[model samples]
Target: MAMSKQQRAAVVAILVAGLLGGAAILFTGKGGGSGEAGHEHGEHAEQGEHVDHDDHDHGHAHDKPAATPASAAAAAAAPAQAADQPHVIKLTPEQVQQAGIGIATAGSAPLRGSVDFPGEIRFNDDRTAHVVPRVAGVAQAVPANLGEQVARGQVLAVIASTALAEQRSELLAAQRREALARATYAREKTLWQEKISAEQDYQQARTALEEAQIAVQNARQKLVAIGAAESAGKDGKDGKGGSLNQFALRAPFDGIIVEKHLSLGEAVKEDASVFTISDLSSVWAEFVVSARDLDQVRVGETVRIRSTASESQAEGKVSYVGALLGEQTRTAKARVTLANPGMAWRPGLFVTVSVLGAATQVPVTVAADAVQQVDGSSAVFVAVPGGFAVQPVKTGRSGGKLVEITEGLQAGARYAAANSFILKSELGKASAGHEH
Candidate 1:
């Protein structure tokens, strides 16, 4: 089938157009980072461009892209706009999970004032005493042992002394003298009534009776003072039932026997110590306060004491805060008086003292979980209309689980208490995209 030249040229042109159109469609589909697909499609475009075609499909299709340059440029700038736009964190249905953010309204409670110090138990000096004999004696029988409880007037020991023997002799002689004085006084009265003796003789007899009675009275008083009972007189109990001059060391006050220095049958001097008694009804807790914390302390303020060695807490009032600080330790001494029940707060015991001070109140407080770090600053995630945002905040004093928010949030604001870190990471990724 022979044809003319114009018909053959027209057939070739149609064939070239169809091939160019197919190659342009392939380039549009492969402009992405897909290496092999783009490489092959670019090769197909180069080959089609060289092809001579009066009717070219790529010529028509490629012209459409140039028509919308402003639109494409604007579309390319969309990612940049997102980067410049303030971050709006989108939460998944699960991520939108609400966290229980604890918030508190500030109120006042008794600010239990407290102070801490290191202390040890000590005996009250004023209430402690040592039993000593007033006169030199030989220790006879020590009836009470060491650590024995004795009452006032309870005999601790009996001492036999040469001084005691002399005192007894004087007492007996004085008793005879008193009896003689009474008889003499009666004789003087009779003599005066009978007028047998002269007035001067009768007056001398009366003066002698009075002097003798005074001497007897002085001797009896001395015996009674040396721990003896007087006047077994008048009841026919006039005989010396007990040794009048035997020194009985008695307790001066109601207390516990802490030390016993004298043994039975041992010779004791006037200065020798027989027993030491401590009144345990009240005890002292000696505490050491640091120099920095000294000003917070005051007398009569209550404090709490506890020991690491045992599970006991004792309450006491500060009896004194030492005027002078320790030169070596640089600590002031605080004396606390605690009621020792059953002698539980023993002397030489180590304890910890807590002195509570005034408390400061704040108007607003939030949970520690609500606070998050953003851009190297402390912030919190606050729920907004569309999404959540990181808000910077200023904080003050902190307590357990709660912290005082001085600024950056108000009452009734919802904040994310948990899972805020996830949002932070997401924001970082969005920033990374714009960088690319």
Candidate 2:
């Protein structure tokens, strides 16, 4: 079987062409970041998430990429894009919805401007009282304790005062003398009518009776000035009664005992503040305003108060504003009175005061939660064809619920509003895969 030279050359060329085609297929199946990323993402997502490959299906196969012109081009461009911009988060409409991320459109909104100031909760001075003993005494029994609620006219403590006893004794003596003088005056008048006594003698008895009555009235008036009841306690000396020195201190109004300076067996001065009671049904939120910002605050205006230590917040009206500024701080103090049910607004708690001003419309605004930090710059996840693209943005003034975007985001652009951290976590994973 002899073969010709031309036929042998043709067989060698066919073998060379087949070998080259196989090598090209092998290379195409092995390399492509996009397909590798998509496969890895789909596999990792299966444990906790469900990703749809519907119309947004990836061009690359799971294990081996199809190596189509579109998939290859995407694979080649992924690294360069990741280096310059945030990675495009690959997600279908169903998957994005299933992820529990609320999508909202950015547009104009009427936002009220606010001025913030630090503040503190304080006792309403109008409802607070510093109780004084009024008379020097030894505290015998102090029933009121610190942080105790008290009712109006409730006995707070008992005081034993020698000075009080002496005054009571004087009143008792004056009463006895006045009784004797009245008897004499009655007898003298009868005798004078009967002509059994001289007119001058009857007149002298009448004058003496009037002088005794005046002495009794003066002594009684003296005891009344020091808050002592003439009928209180025992007047025992030869009369079967209790000690007159015992003085009961009673609360002037219904309140809580916030301060206590007297203890059992303690000697208190006449002017000492033995107790401090305050009606805690209301509290004052106090803040300082700079001289330049005083015009923003006014009496009868409403304000918002937020606790710095917790999530408690409240609304109140500005009740007072100082007419003069502080000499050292150069600021005027202001206060807002608020109803405090359940005692939520406790005194001494630090707070944030927000004074709301007139509203203004903004061009492009979104929910406050939509803005995220990527690479130390603020950015928003914007909706693209198949997924969200990271958009760097510049932020302006912010209301509590909405924020104004000055650059990089257009009106009517849809963005993640709530639960956006899920997208942020996925973005971080995609970036790490590229680095590896």
- The 10-residue segment of model 2 with minimum total lDDT is 232-241
Report, for all candidates in order, the number of backbone clashes.
Answer: 7, 1
lDDT (tens digit, per residue) of candidate 2 on 1-436? 8779998999999999999999988888877766898899788778433334532365444556447899889988987876754468889989988998899999999887788999999999999999987889998888889999999978788888888888888888888988898898889889999999888878888898888889888888877776666854532222244478877777888999999999999999989999999999998999999999999999987788999999888888889999998999999999999899789899999999988877899999999888999879998988788888888999987787799999999999999898777888889988888777
TM-score of each: 0.53, 0.66
Error of 2 at 29 (Å): 47
Which regions of candidate 1 are displaced past 4 Å? 1-108, 193-199, 224-245, 288-297, 321-334, 355-436
The deviation in Å at residue 215 for candidate 2 is: 7.5
lDDT of 1 at 5: 100
Instruction: Note the residue pairs that clash in candidate 1.
Output: 113-356, 113-357, 114-355, 114-356, 114-357, 115-355, 115-356
lDDT of each: 0.73, 0.85
